[model samples]
Target: MQYVPFTPYRRVLTLPRVRPSMALMFFARLPMTMTGVTLTLYVVSNLGHGYGAAGIVGAASTLGMALGAPLLGRSIDRYGLRPVVGVCGVTSTAFWIAVPHLSYAVLVVCALPAGFLSVPAGSLARQILAALVPAEQRRAAYSLDTILVEASFMIGPAAGIAAITSLSATVTLSGIGAIFGVTALLIFLLNPPIRNEDELAPIGSVRPPLRSWLSGRLLATLLVAAGTLFCLVGTEVATLAALRANGDVGWTGLVIVVMCAASMAGGIVHGAVKRSLPQGVLMLLLAVLVLPVGLADQPWWLLMLVLIPTNLLCAPTLAATTETVSTMAPPAVRGEAMGLQDASTRLGLALGSPVVGFAIDHSSPAWGFFAAGAGGLVLAAFGLLWTRRRRPAAVAPALAAAVRARR
Candidate 1:
């Protein structure tokens, strides 16, 4: 139960600076879910356009994220997280204000760059937590940060939906821009943990993780997990339609609430337990746990109950994978690794949407859940194979004897 030094709790919560910085993250992400959802709605609902146009607009932002992350991660590694975060925050704010005016063509182009520029607050927050808090306590710090993120995302969409309905999406969008602009600036001015000079090596060096990332086994393992994440998120979106059709009017929001609440609890526990399980074993365990949600049915109570187990597997596995990736990545190219992690996540969501949407369209909601669950099993199987492959080869008896004799 020993906590790392500099952690808020390790310092007995006496560190106002640490507490405030963490609090800022809550505000930092509050608009994250809202911006894209509301922006898309605003385009279609207010501007009188089809879903295609909205989709294009949304895709533009993802493009930005795909392009921007590595550069920013590199910058954070080189200069510092604060300055990079601040720049991204300001850029995001400016882009938000102008997003509405751009035509569909212009919007798509803008979105790619913007997505790239958008400060990956989640990743940046982790970096700061690592720097400010002692290494051992960092797991707790990340757990707490994940909790804040879970809460923020849960609240953000509802708020965005409400704002668009009450005040108009355009106004809401503008307000969000201002709120974040100030938030990013304030975090910058406060000089959060990202400013710590001693931690420069992780953020600064530009070396590559050639050996680890290129290793066949490790890359395969990451991609498999990435696919599972994609399916899970896509299933969430598809489930809303299923609920409405099933006459469970209120279940849509409830499902999300259940998943996130369960994930938050899971993250807390994962942080508490000091299990030293290898990454591959942990992956398969989590994968198997989520594989049954595909069969959920009518008992309202049963829906909630099943979600607890599935949701529990979500955060910790992802966090574990991320921690593993960081460990394997070299300093020079750590940013690339972080960016790839994010891009992989985004890719999952992106790929999952079409497949889930099609399943729901062609068959039923059950199909979407089925795909998700089965996809998880596929990942689990891949993990098993990957682990096997990663194991060292058997040594030849005569050659082994010669090598040992030399030793």
Candidate 2:
């Protein structure tokens, strides 16, 4: 395709039903970013627990999300968006509201369920894009969605922490619950096209076994998405550890903001640009860029400069993964496919912190950086190899048809 500028994004935004749906999605998903930070702060400051206690609570939620995402996605695919989202919204709201009132032991015990019931807004948003936007325009749409996700990371945690510290944790947590209820209600009212049963019927019409939808191609792309997050989060942890070791811990927030900003900038360009690099290529580049972050250890500014390259690829890799999954899965099972994608990302994020932390503890912060890059490369290689093996087989029938026509 000829290289177009930001015109594609402009066209995408102007399309009917696109703008409002995007807005709803942004509000509805804010809780994803807010929850962990709010929980961390509440557990530590309000409950008078240490970081270790806060971490366990956070892991409970992450584990819940990892387990729940696919099942909920299946529900959305089989039923529809409104009922599934509404139920989740209510359950999640109740849990958040009850968190502060409960004792520490009770809070820990209930944490998993709270996360389990948390709305799968991320997957739902992607499903809407798949259903509403045409295939040709979806790349830009996904890019925009990915950018919003990054924005949530920037806004959600900051807002959540700020509110909890400034106002009462009880009020802030309750307010978060209220936001969930209202966002879910608005989504129900807007009744995005994804809510229509007839539209999703074809996905199940053939009644193909779920195994068929869980194609190798789909799984490989999911791995790429997971690896992308694994590398990104691992690097983040390593960066923090290194900063702490250097007695520059206070600068951590500024450094992260710069890196996220770089990713956002790259995402904007990736969306606006007509042609872009393949997902595999972007993942490989990220691995390479992150590998040397450890060498910049002497000075804080040096670490910031080194991180720019890897961070720049962050959004592009994510946007590309979403676009690939959207293209690979048929409409009938797209929700499940997206759900699997969601699960993979959560798994990566959950694993990244521990893996890098372990490396930092056993060796040094530099080793943590090295491990993130090396681990990311290993995952990227697996994905690339899977694609290489699958491509020729996928096209063989078409090639055979061409040969027969020649004869």
Candidate 3:
């Protein structure tokens, strides 16, 4: 077979449905970034609650998302995209609309259900890309997707904070709900493909058993993905703690922007090149690069400078993980597999904040960086060991077959 070289972003952009689907998904994802900080602000300022109380609500919501993502993905696999989107979109909209009206106690109680039903925009976007972009070109497609994700994060929270501060939480939240409703409607109407035409199974075909597709290699990829997020989020937590400790809190936004920019730059290069580092290697580099960041924490600028190295690996690592998962999963179960990816990353984010926070609280802000990097290395080590252990068994059968043929 003649090899067709990938033309980077140009090839990815030219694919049918890739552009519009990405555009819609980008707007759809903004609410995801906005919701967390917006809810935290609402709980603290409007409900007259402490940050601790707000944290409980945020934790509850995150817990719900973590639990819900895979299940929703399974639903998409079984039922198709529109049905799942319709239900989640309406449920999520109703919850957000009711958020302003609920008491703190009631809001806390409702947060989980609301989060459980929240639109799985990020995973959906990946599913759409996998369906729309051919396998050979997916690296660039996913890289562009990762870049868009970073861009959304850069804008979303700031927009949320600005709106909440300038107006009432009631108004801001209601507006967010409105945006969710509209985006949901658009997604429903658009009904982007979730599987390539050839990969689609017949109606009522037996779904592949979980054991068949959820292989050790796939799990290892998920583990690496979780580790990537754990390191990144932990780094963010450490950066914040470092800034607060150094009386440079005001520079936090600039530092974060710089970090995002560096990640985007890395992603661009990773996609444009014919070859980039594998997910495991990129993740390892990411964790190792941040280990010494604590030493530069004195001035926020210096800390930001130190952070650029690790941050550069960020989007590339994420894009690689998505590409690996997409390749490993059968199209029949791709939604569920993607959902698992979402769950793993969410789990990482959930764990990173507190674990790193504890380190900063007990020792010094510097220790937070240590905690983050160390935790990442530990997770990556486990994935590496797991992959190695599975390899001999995986190869033995093929080797045996080859030996028998020789005989």
- The models' CA-based lDDT, in order, is 0.69, 0.85, 0.93
Worst 10 residues of 3 by lDDT: 1-10
Against the true structure, candidate 3 reaches a TM-score of: 0.97
Off by over 4 Å in 1: 1-17, 194-221, 276-286, 379-384, 393-407
Root-mean-square deviation of each candidate, in angstroms?
4.3, 2.4, 2.2
Ranking by lDDT: 3, 2, 1
Q: Output the number of the lDDT-best candidate.
A: 3
TM-score of each: 0.84, 0.93, 0.97
Q: Give one digit per residue, the lDDT tens place, for model 2 in 26-119.
A: 9898977898889888888889999889999888888888888888887877777888888988988888888889888898888887787788
Q: Model 2 misses residue 104 by how many Å?
A: 2.6
Task: For model 1, state the Cα shift of residue 320 in Å.
Answer: 1.6
Residues 323-396, model 1: lDDT tens digits: 66665665445566677667766766676676677777888776777666556566557756765676554235
lDDT of 3: 0.93
lDDT of 3 by residue, 1-407 (tens): 65344467888899898999999999999998999899999999889999889989998999899999999999999999999999998988888888999999999899988888899999999999999999998999999999999999999999999999999888889889988999999999999999989999987799999999998999999998889999999999999999999999999999999999999999998888888999999999999998999988989889999999999999999999999999999999999999999999998888899999999999998989989999998888888789999998889888999999999
